[model samples]
Target chain A: MKKDKLVIGGHEFQSRFILGSGKFSLEMTNAVIQNGGVEMATLALRRANVGGEGNILDYMPENITLLPNTSGARTAEEAVRIARLARELGCGDFVKIEVIHDSKYLMPDNYETIKATEILAKEGFIVMPYMYPDLNVARSLESAGAAAIMPLGAPIGSNRGLLTKDFIKMLIDEIDLPIIVDAGIGRPSQACEAMELGVDAVMANTAVATAKDVPLMATAFRLAIEAGRSAYLAGLGRVLESKGEASSPLTGFLQD
Target chain B: METKMDHMVYLDYMEQVDSDIMERVLDTVEQYDYNTYIVEDVKAALCKDKLDIDDFGALLSPAAMPFLEEMAQRAQKETRAHFGNAVSLFTPLYIANYCENNCIYCGFNCKNKIHRGKLSMEEMEKELQSISKTGLRDILLLTGESRHQSDVKYIGEAVKLATKYFALVGIEIYPLNTDEYAFLHECGADYVCVYQETYNTDKYEEMHLSGPKRIYPYRFYAQERALKGGMRGVAFGALLGLGDFRKDAFATGLHAFYVQRKYPQGEISFSPPRLRPFINNAEENPKDVHETQLLQVMLAYRLFMPYAGITISTRERAGFRDNVIGMCATRISAGVKVSVGGHEEEAKGDEQFEISDDRSVAEVLSSIESLGLQPVFLDYIRV
Candidate 1:
C-alpha cells in the first residue's frame, strides 16, 4: 500500500543500491556508481597513496556520499584513527566501522566493533557498523548510536550467499533502523533476494569486481535491486496452499 | 649437530645400516608419534649408514621411481597420521613484476620485453579484492628481484594490503635485511619463502647474471633473516632444473635440515618446482628436470624429513599432481595462473607461465574427494 524510500543519514535514495569502492578501476568504478544510481558507496581507508599517485580516492566523485570503511583495521583504535583520517579527507560524518579480529572470516569483533561505534558516534560521527548476523550485537550497536546496521550474509568474500538468512530476517523484523545486507553476495540474485526480504539496501564488491564483465554486472545488479525493492513495495503474491483449487466439476455439480 | 657418521658405532649390531633404527623410526611413525622422538629418530635413521648418500640416492634414483607407489603410500600414511589427509592450498599474488635482476630463467628478468605491472597501494587493494573472492585465505606475495621497485617498504605495503584479505600471508619477494624482515613481520607477514634457485655458488651466479639476487650467500641466508625477524615459518626450496637436480636437492635438503635444527620452533617446508615453459624460448634452457626426478626429490624430502611440508605447483601436469598428492606432497596449488591479475575468468594479458593443472577450485576439490581424500578449507582456524 505504501512505497518505502530508504534514507540513510537524512539522504533519501530512491534506489536502495549501495556500491562498493573496491574492484574496478577508478573510472570504471565511477561509471558503475553513476549508472547504478547508488546514493552511497563504501570506501576502505588504509595506508595507501591518497593523492593523485594511483589512489582510489582520486577517482571518487564528490557527489556520492562516501562511507569510509575500517576494512583493514584489526583493532578499535586503528579503526578510530582511520575514521578520523577519512573525515579529515572530506569523507563527511558517516563511518562504516569494521573491526575484524579474525582475518580469515573477516568477521567483525562484536565487542571491539561496538566499542569503536560508541567512540565514533560520541565524536559526532554517523556510525554504521558492518557486523556479523548476530541480532544481539546489532541491537547493541544500534543502542550505541549506530545509524544503520550491516549484517553479513556469510563470511566476507565467501560468496556463499545468505547463509545467515534466518538470523538476518529475524533482525530485520526486530530492528527499527535500516538493515543493510553486506558482503558474501556472489550473484545478483542474492542481492535481489535480500531486497525482497525488506532489506533497505545491499552493498557488494566481489560479485561485481571479479565478474567477467564488471560494468555489465554492475548494471545487472542495479536492475536486480530495483526489481527486488519494487516487489517488496508492491507486496508479494500470496503463497498457495496444496489443498486449495477453484474448479467447476460436473461430477460434483449437485453436491452444493 | 656436528657428529660424524660412525660405522663402528654399529659394530656390535648388524652393521648394514641399522634396520632396528629404521624400524624404530618406522615404529614411531606408525604410532603417529610427532614428539622429539620422531624427529630424533628420523634424524638418527638418516644419520645411520643405512641412510647413506647412496641409500638417499637409492631412494630418489630411477629405480626408486617404481617404489614411488610404495613410497607415496608410506608418505601418505605418515602425512595422514601426522598432518591429516587434507592438502593445504594457497595462491601467490605477484604484486610487482619490475625487476633489477637479470636471471636467465625468469619471465620477469630485467631484460625481458614485457609490460611490467606494479600495483600501487590502491591497485594492490584492488588486486586483493579481486583475489579475496576466490575463497583463499593463505596467500603468498611475490615480486621480481628489484630493489628499486620492490624494496622493503614496497613488500611491507603489499603485506599490509594482503593482511586486509588473508589470514596467512607469505613473502617470496626480494630478500631483505633482518630489520626489514622484522618490519614486514610487524606489518603482518607470517612466512617468507626465498628459494636459492640454485645453491651452487658458481651456478647461482651464472643463473642470476645481474642483480642483487646474484649474491649467493645473501639469498642463502634469507630464511635465517626471516626467522630472526620473528617469522613463524620459513620455506626453503630449490628451483629444480636450474642446475643439477641431485646437487640442488642435496643442498636444499641440507639447508632445510640446518634451519630446522637451528630454529626448532619455526615451521619448515620445501618445494621442488621444476622450470616450466617461459617466454623467449626460455623453456629451451638446459637442465630440464623430469617428472620422475621431481618425484624422486619429493620422496627423498619425505623420507629424509617426514615432518617437512612438500609443495608441488601447477607446473606439473594434472596426472602428476594427482599421483603426488598422496605421496610426499603436503601442499599444492590448484587452478593456478602464474600471470598477474589472473583471477578473472579471462586472462587480462600474457601469463608468466602456463599452468599445467588448469582445474577450478571446485574441480580440484572434487578431484581430491574422488581420490577418497577429504578436501578441507580453513582447517586451522577456529571459526
Candidate 2:
C-alpha cells in the first residue's frame, strides 16, 4: 500500500486526494496543499489582474499538478473557450471540464461535457470531466478521449454525502477508466467509505474548506483517504446473518 | 389626483394613483395575509434545513418581525458560506441624465426645467480613466432612458472603451429588445440591471407618466432578454417607497426566483433602492422606510435565495452600508455619481438624486475590514 500510486492521464500521484481551491482563504492555499500532502489541485481561470489579490498560481507550490476547471461555462463553446484560454496561461495540458447549465440543480451537462472534452482532448489537452453518473456517458467520454471519469457524489457544495453512492459504484463496476468520485463529500468518514467501495479517489472542497479549522480538516481528510485505501487493500471480512459459535460453547455440559 | 396619504393602501383601494397595471394581478396576490407569515407556515419553513418558495408568504408576514435578528444571523452565516468574506465592489458612473418623461415625483421629469445632457464620447473615456484609476475594476455604465442620445449604439461605444480598464462591466439603462441586449454583450457589456421600480404596475404607470418605459411587460422582461442575449448575469430590483415595502420586497424576491428558474445559467441579484429626494423635485415627501425595515428585507432576501447577490448603494448612508455589508448584502456600489459627466470633470449638472454617503472606495474598504471581512473588488474574469 505504501508503494501504491494513483495514475491518471499518464501522470502518477502518490496522494489520491485532489484539493479544490475555491471558497478557501488565500492564506490557506499553500497549507491545504502542503500539509494535506495533496499532489494535485484545481483552480478556476480568471482574468489576470495587474495588482490586488494576485493569481491563484502565486500561492501554489512549485511541483504540484494544476487542473484548472471551467467552472463558469454553461455550454460546450464556452467550456472550450475557457480551456483554450487556460492552456494559454501555461498551466500545462491538464483541464477540468465542468459544463453546468442547470443553475437550480447545479448539475453538470454531460452532453456538453463530452463535446468539450472531444474538442479539447484532440487539441493536445488532458481532459478530466466532472459529470453526473451515467455508464453510457462514461463510455462516450472515454471514446471522446477523456483521461478520467469524474462522477459527482451529489450536487456541488451540497455537503450531502453519498446520495449518489450506488450510481458511483455502478460506474466503478462498469466503466473501464478510473472512476473518481467528485463533489458533495461532506465528512472524512464519507471519503473513507468511498474508497472502501472501490472508488479510485475522492475529490472535494466544501468538506474541508467550510470546516471550523481548514488545515486541520485537510489533515483529517488525508488520513481518512489513507485509511480507506489501506482497508480496501487489506480485504474487509464478509457480513453474516447469525453470530459465530463461541470459543467455549454452552454445549460443554460441565461448564454450563 | 393629489392626496395627503395617511397610510399606504391596497392599489385597488387607492383612487389617486392609476390602478390599471395592478388590477389583474392584485386579486391573486392579495388573498394571502403575508403580514402573519412568520408565525404561520414560514417559521416551520425557515426551521427546516432547506427552504422553498412555499415559505415565502410566511417570511413576509408581520409575524416575521420578532424573528428579524434570528433571520439576520442565518443570513450572515449562509452568505459567508456561499460568497465568502468578500463583498464585490462596483461604482456607477452616470454618463447621461437626459430623460424624456413627465413623471410627477422625479428629479428628471421633462417639465422640471433642468439641464439635459449626455457625456460626449471623449468625456465618457475620460470618466472611465478617472474611475479605473480608483483601482475599482467592476464598472456599471448608466444612462438616462433616452432613445435619441443614449441609444444602443451610444451605450455600445461606451462599453467598448470600458472593456479596456474594467474586467466586469454592467449597465442600468433603458430596456432594449433581446437582439439589442445581445449587441451590447458582443460590444463588451457583461451584465444588465433593470429595476421594475414598483411591482404594483398601477403605481408604476402613474409614476412613469409617458415614455417608452411605460410599457410594463417590456421592462419586466428586460432581464430575461439580457440573458438570452448572452449576458453573463442580470440584476433585478424595485424602488422601495412607491408601494408597500413588504409587498414590494416579496414581489421582487418572487420575480428573481422565477428568473433564476428560467435562466438557470445566469447570475441573479436583487437591489431594493429606496426613494430619495432631489433638488427641484415637486413631490419631496416620499414615504420613509426605516433602516430596520431595510435590514429585515435584506435578511428575507438572503433566506429565500441564498445564492443571489444583495446590493446596497450610496442611496443609503455610510453607517447603514457598513452595517449590512458583512451581515447580509454581498455587493455594494461605492463612490457613486448620479449626474452626467460627474466623474471626470466639474459635476455642475443636476444630479438625479443627492448621494447620502460620500465615502470613497478606500473608505468603504477600510470600513468593511474593520468588521473582520475582506472587501472583494473583483469576482468575474473575462477569460
Candidate 3:
C-alpha cells in the first residue's frame, strides 16, 4: 500500500527513494531496486558509453524512472546542453540539473542553476535541481518549474550526513516543492531522520554503493525510510527542550 | 648579432617602453640616493599612515636589511588581513619544451642539450587525468617560446582542454599580440604569465641571444596586451638573478604597480622566481641571488603591492617555500612536471629544470596545512 505516492510530470511513482547509479557496478542496480524498492535512479550524462560500461541506461530495469544529471556542467549553457542530450537519449523528461563551477569546494552555483532551470522548464523537461541550501534560490527554482529541489546534505561522496540540516529544515518549512535530501548521507539513520523532518524523499549513492554489501545496505535504507515516513504520518510528538513532557500524566500514578 | 656588454648602449628595451609611468619608475631607479637616508627612510615608512613610491624604493635599499624582521612581521600581518589563511594550489603542465630563444639561464634554452617533448591531445588527457585524480582544480600550462611547435593555436587548444579538468586555467608561454591574446582568452584561458628574465636590458640581451624574446619592451608589456585581449588576470615576474637584484626588484615592483593602477579592475599577480640549475647548463654563476635577498625582494613586493598575489615556486627548497607561503605568498605550484607527457606516474621524460621540491600534490597540501593554513585548490567560479 503506497501511503504517499510521488507525482512528477504526470507520472506516479510508488517509491520516494532515488538510487544514484554512479561509482558502483551496474549489476547492483537490479538487486537494489528489487530489495530497496526505489522508484527512480539518477545517472550522470558524460562521454557516451560512460566509464566504458556501454550505455548505463541499458543496465537499468525498464520500470525504473531515469533522472539524468547535469554533473559535468560548469555553466548554465553547459547544464542545458546536458539536459537536452539526456532527453534526446530517451531517458524521459526528468532531469537533475547540477551547475557547479567551484571545483575546489564543489559547491553548486545557485544563480547558474536558476538560469538552467528556466531554460529547461520552458523546454518541457521535468527539472529537479541539486543545489546549495539557500532558501532564496529554492524559491527561484520553484518559479523556474522545477519538479523538486534536492539540496546537498554535504559535499558529494563525502558521506558526512546532514551538515546542513538547519538549512534543509528551513527549506522544508518554507518551499512548497518536494525537498529530497541528496549527497553526503552516509547512514540509513540519517536518511530516516531526513524523512522524519518531512522531506519528500531521500537519495544516497555512495552510502549504499560503497558498502561491502550494496543490496543488504539498500534494504536497511528502505526499512529506515519507511519507519521514518510512517512516524511523520502518525504525527510525531514535539521535542520539549526545557524538560521532558511526560507521555503519561504525572498525577495518574496509582501511588498518588 | 651581439651588442657590446655595456649596460647603457643596450638600454634599447628601456627606451622602447613608451609609458610615462614606466619612465618615471626607471627614472627613480636612475636618480634615487639609496646611500643617503636608507635606514631612516624605511623606518619612517614603517611609521607612516600611507606608503608612497619613495617609501617602497627605500624598502628595497641595503639599509632596510637590518629591519627585515620588522618588514616580514608587518608583511605577514597584512597578508593574513588580505588573503586570510587560504593557500591556493595549482600544478604546471608543460605542453611543449620546444624553444627558439637562447636564454642561457633557462633549461629550455635552444642551446641547452636536453630532451624536448610535446604532448598530443591524447597524452594531454592522460596527464590531466593523473592531475585530476589528485583532486586539484587549478592548473597552469607552461611552454617555451617556440613558434614552430607551441604556437598560439596549440596553446589555445591546451587551455580549452584544461577547462575540463580544472576550474581555473593559466598560461605561461610566449608573448603574443593583443589579437592573439584575445583569441586565446576566447579559447577559455583566464590568465597569461610572462617572466622577463631580467629587466636590466644588458643582462637581457646577453641572456637572450637570438629570438623573439630579445625585444625587452615587448616582453615587458605582455601582461598589458593580455589584459587588452580580455584575460581576467595577468601575472608578471623576473628571473631574479641575471641583473642587479635591487634595481630589478624595484622595476619589477614598479611594473606590477603601474599595471595594477592601469587595470585596477583586473587581477594582477607577481612571482620572483630564482634561477634553478639544469643539466649541462650551470644554472648558477658566481654572481647569484642569495636566499636573504630573495626574502627581502618578496617582502618588499608585499609591502609595495599588498593586494596582488605573490607565488613562491618549487625553485626554493620545501622548507623555504613552506616558510614564506602563509606569510607573503598566496599561490604555489605542486605536483609540477616541467616536461611534456609528464602525467604518467612513472614518466619523468624531460624536465625543463630540476625542481627543488619533488613532492606530490597531496604531500604539498599537507605541508600547507601543517603550517596552520587552509589549502585551496580552486576559488573562482564562472557564473
- Candidate topping DockQ: 2
Rate residue A72 of model 2 by lDDT. Answer: 80
How far is A26's C-alpha from truth in model 3 (Å)? Answer: 35
Write candidate 3's Cα lDDT for B1-383 as tens digits. Answer: 65533333323323232456546656766776666656789999888645678888888888998999999988876565445565778888887888888777777788877787778888888888889888787788988788788888988889899888877789988888888889988888888898876877767778777777777667777888888787878887887777787788888888888887776645778888877777786637525688888999899888877767889888888998999986899998888777776678444347777788879988988887777665765555332
Top TM-score model: 2
Regions of model 3 farther than 4 Å from truth = A1-256, B1-21, B345-349
Candidate 3 residue-wise lDDT, A93-129, digit = tens = 9999988744224578899999999999999999999
- Model 2 C-alpha lDDT per residue in residues A1-256, reported as the tens digit of each score: 3677888888898998888776666567788887789988987775234365435667778898998889888889989998898788778899999987765567999999999999999998989999999889999999999989999988777778888888888888887777788888889999999888888888978778777788999999999998988888888887655766556767668753
Q: Which residue ranges in model 2 land beyond 4 Å of their true spot?
A: A47-54, A240-256, B1-28, B36-38, B281-288, B366-375, B381-383
Which candidate, 1 or 3, would have the higher TM-score against the true structure? 3
TM-score list, all predictions = 0.52, 0.89, 0.60
User: How many Å off is the CA of A120 in candidate 1?
Assistant: 32
Error of 3 at A86 (Å): 22
User: Scored by Cα lDDT, where does model 3 land?
Assistant: 0.79
Q: DockQ rank, highest first?
A: 2, 3, 1
Fraction of native contacts, model 3: 0.00
Q: What is the TM-score of chain A in candidate 3?
A: 0.91
Tens digit per residue, CA lDDT, model 1, A169-220: 9889999889999888878899999999989899887677655566788898
Write model 2 residue lDDT over B194-253, tens digit each, in one string.
Answer: 988887767776776776666666677778778888888888887887777777777777
